[model samples]
Target: MTQTTQTDRTTTGAIPVPARTGVHELDPAEAQSAREVALRLVATAGAVVDDEKWISAAAAAWQELPLSLRHAVRAFRRHSGSRGTLLLRGLPVAVDELPATPGHGSSVQRRATVPAALIMAVASGLGDPIAFAPEKSGAMVQDVVPVAGREEFQGNAGSVRLSYHNENAFHPHRPDYVLLICLRPDHDRIAGTSTACVREVLPLLSPAGREALHAAEFTTAAPPSFGAGGERAGAHAVLTGPASDPDLRVDLAATRPLTARAERALSELADVFETVGRTEVLTTGDLVIVDNRVAVHGRSRFTPRYDGSDRWLQRTFVAADLRRSRSHRADDGHVLI
Candidate 1:
């Protein structure tokens, strides 16, 4: 897909905000095959989503997927392009039998469903699923829906324009990939999930702006959902690792520049994101995988009725290697303590 960027710094942001209109969809046969595997795993797991054997079985099934599909998933896992996002449409999500969108969060029953199993199957292709103990009862898959009282809040439950952010940016064990599966879309179909890749925005940065972002002059506060309250993380660079294609870790809603120069640099970066970020309106059976290290994601504002038919999405955090967080987990489990 082609999109133009608005470069007028006075009127437009540094990056031109555009919507992603293209998708990488699976063929009908592939979708059916994936559904069969997912349903089999769901039946085997029964009502237990946290069982190690069940998860392992799901992973093993993922390995048996068609080589072509596996290769595509692996390529994205290794390196996403300037968009830093992969949209897979027509994955088998058993929506007809799905219960009403959970207004609160994921439950064991929901986790054992076919859609959840499909998510786990896809995640196995990328990495190990992980969750934080303080969030959503440490369930590996979290239900994203607009909560009744959190409409204006900048969080998963809010219907407002959520600021772009790396998943769990303040945590040392933050996820490497954020997998979101759409079970139900917003009524108006206008609620788009936005993503901005540092790869795309880096070219727009001035040398001074790039230098400032590479320095350790920014601090990010832990979102309230993490239960850290007002806790802030140590000083760190907004961009780090290799200079050619650095990693990104900034939460527009929670990050703060620690100096005057850093503040100006951050403002410039924000403009770049606004000018280039792309939004995608997810549909049922669509899974959007994001490289959390190379890009940030947020959601656009949309009205939610709070009725049973509101938008619904399931999210999971994944790491390329789970062993890195061994010390932060119990029995070296998926849940990060």
Candidate 2:
């Protein structure tokens, strides 16, 4: 793909260079403070790591971070430019004796580890941590690794190029943000996480295409991880909010158009993504937070050996407001049942 020049003004329906990806490199003191907070939370929650009480306690502890660090997070949360993705580097994570990639097995026992605790602390700063009842048996933190027999599957268990998607787009209560922390990178370090935002590509769309996207003529089916409830989202618009700067919600892998015009519009959107998307290769101690409402994310193809040392990334989801899904959960719990 050819690269477009960086400019605020549009030139013949082309996408300008997007605002750079948001990245914050933690200083030694800030990294140490984060480690201390994670350790304190681990000590506080002795037996149960996923307990709602314990998670809430961790969020409260996260609020006590230094004002400068807190301000940076707040600013990113409110306005992360056109990319809608943020990467935090140099966070302290204990990875010694880390278990091999679990494939499709249980991750319950791994939740009590120091890395998991650290993820919770950082995720809480963005929003309330959440989980889907059907994914990984409702575990808040999930392991993203290639499975033994599911290499071609489109979901997290595959090494194939996973198409761009808004996390959990088939559900009524999709996450507002998605977090992925790297403990071990792919063996060859060739895997890349791809992200694209409508804000960066809106100018590239024709008026007819934009009009078709705003109409409710598309549907997205839930991924296999969601189990029996993996049905299609009915009659939804791909774009919403202001016409000048719209929000996006469409899974290129699972979504389908109801009409020929909608199909053409969807293809145009994909073309823009191919030209404007940014890809990143995450390494150890790197945490990436994606604004799900504004950006769509996907993964590139990589060879996973499954030799207990393959690519391993821990993922967690968050919602800006938990109360919206109050009725879907029981007793104000974190998981949506």
In model 2, residue pairs whose N, Cα or C atoms come closer than 3 Å (at least 3 residues apart or on different chains), thus clashing, are none
lDDT per residue (tens digit) for residues 123-242 in model 2: 788888999887888887888888877888888888999989999887889999898988888999988889998889898999999999999999999887776556789999999889
For candidate 1, the clash count comes to 5
Model 2 score (lDDT) = 0.82
Q: Model 2, which residues run further than 4 Å from truth?
A: 1-21, 105-110
Each candidate structure's TM-score, on Cα atoms with residue i matched to residue i, is 0.90, 0.90
Clash totals for all candidate models: 5, 0
What is candidate 1's TM-score against the reference? 0.90
Candidate 2 — worst ten consecutive residues by lDDT sum?
1-10
Model 2 RMSD in Å is 9.6
> What value does the lDDT take at residue 236 in candidate 1?
96
Which regions of candidate 1 deviate over 4 angstroms?
A: 1-23, 105-110, 228-230
Error of 1 at 79 (Å): 1.2
Pick by lDDT: which candidate is best?
1
